[model samples]
Target chain A: MKTPLIDNLQYANFSPAIFEQMRAGGVDAVHVTIAYHETFREMVLNLERWNRWFEDHPDLIFKGTTAADVSLAQKTGRTAIFFGFQNPSPIEDDIGLVEICHQLGIRFMQLTYNNQSLLATGCYEDDDTGLTRMGRAVVTEMNRVGMVIDMSHSGERSTLEAIDHSTRPIAITHANPHWWHVALRNKSDAVLKALSGAGGMLGFSVYPHHLAGGSDCTLDSFCAMIAEAAARYGAEHLGIGTDLCQDQPDSIVEWMRVGRWTKGIDYGEGSASNAGFPPMPSWFNDNRDFGNIRTGLLNAGLEIAQVDGIMGGNWHRFYQQGFGPA
Target chain B: MKTPLIDNLQYANFSPAIFEQMRAGGVDAVHVTIAYHETFREMVLNLERWNRWFEDHPDLIFKGTTAADVSLAQKTGRTAIFFGFQNPSPIEDDIGLVEICHQLGIRFMQLTYNNQSLLATGCYEDDDTGLTRMGRAVVTEMNRVGMVIDMSHSGERSTLEAIDHSTRPIAITHANPHWWHVALRNKSDAVLKALSGAGGMLGFSVYPHHLAGGSDCTLDSFCAMIAEAAARYGAEHLGIGTDLCQDQPDSIVEWMRVGRWTKGIDYGEGSASNAGFPPMPSWFNDNRDFGNIRTGLLNAGLEIAQVDGIMGGNWHRFYQQGFGPA
Candidate 1:
């Protein structure tokens, strides 16, 4: 059996060193986001930089927007980099932009980051209106455009609505089930049911703040949480969206708190930052070098197929459906 | 039979002359949108203008955000102006912005204008993702913030999801059911059912492009269309959202076509424009001056109570549920 190792999601600040770390860790592929609240010019400029980097080191960075692309990259021993969006803000109010972004190779799109937008309500909103009229139209457009709708920061109503309205499977690219932790950021069983019932994927986030024990959460406890979700919503739809903000400065934390960059309500007051974990252990200080998750799963006696799906196969399948022919 | 006459929605580039016309025509109230894609500076400027205008003519302009406010305005014979939004783009990704705008007297909020945004998807998106994660959170926040969720330009997925996700009833502040006219801009019967089932309101738009006969549609035909919707969805949940873009410049049309203030794809080709109807015809052109819809309903022999609901009573109730007090 070809034991595949994939890191479905990570939000490390992009750098040459990070790329080198990913390559060194034998990481097969990762979804990289481009869209946020940045102006179109800024997004385009970032894309240009990414394109240059990929071109400069084809051995390290391979553009992948489909499951087949990831598989191909894995076979070639190159890390696949799937384009994604942390928010749909760049699309503005035009539904036509969905297709435009799809053409530009954005396979995964998180509806909102920390705040409310045109498509649906975000997690930080006091009241979740679910999906709006425009949000419904967006679901159809994403379906038509073959882009995977990721509801990591979405509100409950909007999340369920997307699940019902989507023609294909959706994904919670990074979220913890509320069962594991009762935070506004966590997904409820109803949400999990809706997502899985629609053949969608739920990428469990490894952020300590969202876990029940906060900073006290351990990798074993996190894996147990995943097992609980699997028991409830099936393992096929389970995956990982580590949501690792590695190499980000403390100023970035302040930016997120101010709702400037993250665009959400401040969660610092009551929530744990690093859960209870000590400042990033030496091996995982850089998310790119965090190879212990796979090993952790193996140590837990999970099957290779289950571990493979959790690591990357689920995300790979999701992308294949979103990006059309490999 | 006391047949009430009201304009459900209108976005007049307001002037003293327009206010004079509204008062002269015995118009009871108008839903005035304050939120567009304007920058914070522009929004503040517009608000200032409105504040000064209201202060200067308290007897003519009454601020409102709920059905009770409309009733109060009606009793006082003052034309109530309910603060509303055509798009939530001004709020951007900030969920707190909803409350800020709500405190500023904005009552109605459409998730998207004509395209994809962070909260919900627009009607024109090739694939409607319905509500984004943030969109859901926004809805919840809106509900908590006491702002009505409007789904005029929102896509199908977003609309249905919004209806399902909202703890309170939602509204399509301006729209036509697709069953009456198969335009992509209209809602389907299923969507209408979901919306109404959730105790939401459907404000039938009087735009010629959305009517069965397009530009050829007369006031009688427009009323007939409402009658059809009333027959199907019931008059209680059916109201008017005139969508009267009176006094708006041709440039606004051009902007709407490109999906943003700036240019991109032009989806407005062959689409109807208010140009031909400039000095708008009776009933819809200058909705305030047109008594034809009231006459048409009476001519059709509908009950005065039903007409009242269709005119503005239902919308008033919607606002009451969305925005407390006045």
Candidate 2:
């Protein structure tokens, strides 16, 4: 059997072209962020959009809810689109919605999105309160319902507390290590050590802000960072989560960062001068260019198995262990 | 390998007890009616309930959308609970919601219940107008989206029109032959002939009033009716639907019969004196009694292959053919 290739995080405005590119890239599964800061009903509308895509492109993709779906996608030569939330806004204040969202085929939900949510503190918040009371209950509920507690945009204390409180191994679905790139969204060394030590996963982000050299970051630098992280964290929990905002209008970035939370603009990673998505590194432009990363990882002194795991195999294993009731 | 066992239709107040009985009966899959006269939002609440059941009892049941789920259910020793709608109220007046409902895993949608709808004339209507403009559009849309057009409670002209209008073979998901038992819900010879001739399916209903002798109907008589149906309509198009309203209270029956359409009770299949769910025949008490029908079919001089098909294999083949983009 071919090793599965998965992109564990993306927020692309998906189309048939992207799905075709996924097939060309031999990507078995992709955990697509269906909700960033949308309300419960709004998240359902997003699901409706995806449902239309699934109907329109059955030959290229289908909804993926389990690890076995990766194998199914590989066998069928299609991409399995798994749903995730970049924020816990979809659940609102209801703990019951954790299981409800899981039933809707959502497998991952970030506790915060660069601000204080009902559950936890975001990375951008001044004061880092750990897991709130609701957060602890939601963590337990998420564990019970097989929905992974994602902490990609959450504060360090909150992320650490999530890793501590969750009976199931949580995930930083997309973000880099702070030691590699000092972006607010990136994880610190302590957080990385704690995450991996607790059998949690850290999916490397290719979003420009999370990169050391921003848009000008080379494939070699990216691969070297992967190699370094693998060396430090032991490669088992490493995988790619290319937060690729492909084909989306700059307006979507505003929605992602701002999303009815504020009247005026809050330029998340970008300044007023550059308040939009940045250019991708040329070598890793899109899914079809995943070959470049694999080649780069191999050239960066990583073994074939390590490269394979980083590409998708690790996420596959993580999905197997993580997306089921504890 | 054991032959798959499927019940093509039911509307039980499903619980762990019902799911366990389904396992005890060795049923692989069941097509459950999730909507009777519920509006779109109300139906979502019902889906939430089923989702809870699935989460709570993963060992016993899981949602089934495709035909492959049957084999998967049998292999995993669980029942695949497939979804359907006995009425098109959930879709409201929007043709787009057809595909949306299909995306939400609704496999079957009847054009009407017991009154004239936006789509077609119900069986109890004064005049039988065929497929409406919306009905034809919905039929084509349903075919394209792979949701079955169930004509169980539709008027004769409408049912025939649907059988002809549908690019894909429509289904009388839970109804009996009118020749065997004269009832408003039972289909006529012409309808069944057109259904089978066009590669459609007839899921025999044991819904008390549809049976010749009501609740006291014998196993021999029921299986003999199956034998007669196989003789007339061909065994390939026949399977069990049961219409098993198991564990539902009289109030639920009231809802099924007189949703929000009328202020007064309609008593769909029963009179004012008998306006509640009737007791099931002694031979077919619940899902656990499926074995009795299998034996009854064999005793009624059907070959083992024929028995197997009626039991579930035929419905499995129908499901495979029916549930996909056409």
Candidate 3:
């Protein structure tokens, strides 16, 4: 069978139309962000929405809890949607919520978004304190329960600390290399090296702000960057996350940035001149364009086997290896 | 392989001591009430406490999610603690919370708890309007999701409505027959008949207020009453719930009856002369005394199989048949 197509991260304004696009693209699995800056109760409300969607369109998509669910969806000709969080707000101050979120099928959780969380410092913070007292407890609990610690939006120190502290392999689920892109959201070489060296993964992002040329970055440029990342950090640990925020309202990005943390707007990743979600590169706008990425990776002097693994095989193995009890 | 000792209802001030008592009593499983008047968030806090207990005492007790857990608990020499709610307050006004609560291992939820909740009228309400619109929706959702719809403290009309409304067999997890007990918490004859006719269970409660003569009632009286209930509703429809609120302070009863609803004390099920929890029956005070009831049932002239069913076999069958997706 063709390699199962998986997007390690997405935060779409989900609907049946998008689900249909997933099937049309042969996408077996997509880790969808159910909470950005939501509290535990608010995160439950988001899950309720997904539950409704799953009930309404059982033939289109289903909630995926294990790596085997990808194969199940593939055999059934449907897409499996896994749940995740973009920030630690969903867990709030409670370390118990780490297991609770895992029980609810939250496979990935970023410790920080763009500011200091109760657990760790975000990339936007001036001082880079690694992990708080609660952060260490939460990391051990998350490791015990099989929830991946994603540090895509976390500070450099916090990311490195989490990699060393976690007993299980972690992931920077949707970040490019800082050397490839001069963006605060991208990962530094040290973070990437520590992550990959520890059997972790680095999913290359297609989100404009994390790309070299923003929305104008070409398919060749993106894939060649992935080829370079594979060379630096072994092809087995490289995959695609895309950081796709498909069809979401611009106001959502504001919530992702400013959720109850401040009384004023922060305008994350954008300024007054461009204060909204940037357009996607022409070659990759939706799920249907995963083929462009696969073709581009092949043209970037990567072997067919490497391209297949980068597309989704690597992530499928990661899901199998780490998304369960330690 | 003796019949599993399962208490279908409890709200004890749980600890290692109580769990030790459960082991001494040879209890295999318990349906523990995790909420009374708690909101969804507050109920979660209660679950977090239980999570801590389960973590700390895995050898003595563990969280039970399925009927098979009873057998597992028996094999492992531990008590499996199943979760339930005595009121609809945990779900608030959201029907979606039914499925979410079920997913979180909530096996049972009451429609009301001695007041006019958003779902249905409680036994304490003046006018019995039966099931509200939301109550109907919640019952169907609960049925679909394998959560037992419990109406142990509901009004006659509301209980009858629930018995008819739910496709799966509902339960009165902790109440005696009103004809025998003359208490507001007890089920009326019609409610009991309908419940039994629909293959439901009536877990006889030993709470002092629900007894024929309160704390003065004898073990023979309780066992004889169980015999009469078996004559009317068959032995396959009976079990013991006990409602053992062991080691709880009197203040906990106040919270159960008047939680944030009234500014002044309501003195539920008690007179002004005695405004706290009444003494439990002399023959039954804690988990270690279940053996007395088993012996009393046999002396009350029940066959061994009939007595065994009343102990826990009936509820085990009900759990296996009902606690899964319809």
Candidate 4:
């Protein structure tokens, strides 16, 4: 069987058209986050809406719990929607809430948004003390609940401390390596080693700002970076978390910049316009569809098997280990 | 200068005597789980207790967020304690709680305990569904918050999904490879490969049951396994997440058996405990002390630098990437 296309990561506004686009792209599954600055209640409402959307568009979307589910969805001509959270804000004070939300079908969770919180420090934190006692409790609880802990926007100290404290494997859902591009968003070689040592996965994002060449980046450059990482780490350890923010409203950008839905950060206002960055070339914008990732991989000279693994096989195998047929 | 003895994993009931022993053993740092099903709440409630303990026992313990912190602690005649969690229950449903807890010094988080939860599947679960929708959210929020996602007890699917979903590096705090012993408790070759691809860490535990020869297992046997993994994935991709449940009550055995705080698994409840299981051998029990890992590594004829990494240096470097400055 041909390896299915698995986009390990994506962040996009939901709509029927998008769902159809996902199906058109032959994307077996996509990791979708729900928690932002929205309150837990609001997040839940959104989750219900998405769940209902999936229910209404059964032909277009299927809820995925394992890699097998993605494969199954593909076989059945559907898109697997793997749910996640971009922020931990929804789970406010009670660590037990991690389990509750987890049970509710929120798969991936980032520890912070842009600013610091009670748990570990955030990427923007001027001072980071790593994970706190409650943060440690949250890690253990996450492990207990079988939730995947992510550290894309987290501060260095918190991320490392969380890695040490966790008894299981962890991941960096969508990030670039600092070795390729120096910035808070990029991970260091040491970090990669530690994560790989623990049997974790690193998903690369297609965010231009995080790229080595900045706004002047292209799919070829991205592929080169991935190839280098594969040479250093191995293709099996690498995958794609596209981090595509398609159909996202400008308000969402404002929310991201402000650090909260209602309040804004000191340095930036509503939305830090990306207009300064080179506009997405026509091909690139149209390529935002998940199918293009497969085409991109093929164009990069990646074998079909390799592409499959990066697209979804690796994730499927991973899911089998954690959540196979009971 | 001689490399300091660092315990990558340890879970002895905290006490002044233990701290003193660690100090006398020339230990540089330790990854201490702040949450366990048995003492989950106690650990959270007594955060100040640990902080106070570190404060009063400056000669013995210091808080650590990076490898440098451990080195600094060692230079200052102190043991660096990296706060960790064995579960994710503390965060409850709110992703924001991740940040809250991270701020308090919690560093690492394991996705599940022994059974199913909201995020992913566990090793003990009959069906490992990998990362749930909520699990994916946990991974994403963890990425944003900087908390490390751990999958030692997580099912295979969830582990891989977490790897695929994360944007930073991850870790497996404590686990043995199925290549060493094919048990649910062990990781598969594919999992290890994926982990290396992500540039993560694998902290091998000294759990007796996980050894090939069971109770007769020795430090040399453990080293052999580590060597095998290192040969396959490189030494830098390995570390130690010794699942030392030192000083834990017998209830812990029951807890481990059936995912209960005070009860055993239905099958384990009535059956006579396996002779080679549970209590482990006296040697293994006494060897739970973090200091012994170094001696055992030396006894197994590992290189000093290799031992240093397994002991804690590798983990320290990992922390530097995950967490920022202490």
Candidate of highest DockQ: 3
The TM-score of candidate 4 is 0.49
Model 3, B291: alpha-carbon shift in Å?
Answer: 1.6
Query: What fraction of the true interface does each of the listed models get right, in terms of native contacts kept?
Result: 0.00, 0.11, 0.47, 0.00
Among the numbered candidates, top TM-score falls to 3
**Weakest 10 consecutive residues, lDDT, candidate 4 chain A?**
A268-277
- Flag the better candidate by DockQ, 3 or 4: 3
Worst lDDT 10-window in candidate 3 chain B: B268-277
Model 3, span B1-326: residue lDDT tens? 77898899998899899999999999999999999999999999888888889878989999999999999999999999999999989899898888889888999999999999998999999999999998899999998889999999899999999999989999999999988989899888888899999999999998899999999999999999999999998999999999999889989999999999999988878878987778999889899998999999999999999988888999999999888989
* DockQ for the candidates, in order: 0.01, 0.20, 0.65, 0.02
* TM-score of every prediction relative to native: 0.49, 0.83, 0.97, 0.49
Give the fraction of native contacts in model 2: 0.11
iRMS per model in Å: 16.1, 3.2, 0.8, 11.2
Q: Sort the candidates on TM-score, descending order.
A: 3, 2, 1, 4
What candidate 3 gets wrong by more than 4 Å, as runs, is A1-3
User: How displaced is residue A18 in candidate 1, in Å?
Assistant: 43
Error of 4 at A7 (Å): 1.8
Docking class of 4: incorrect
**Cα error of candidate 2 at position A77, Å:** 6.7
**Candidate 3 whole-model C-alpha lDDT, 0 to 1:** 0.91
Query: What TM-score quantifies how close candidate 1 is to the native fold?
Result: 0.49
lDDT of 1 by residue, A32-128 (tens): 7675666543455556567657757877787776677767876888788877787887677767656556655788887877678888888878888
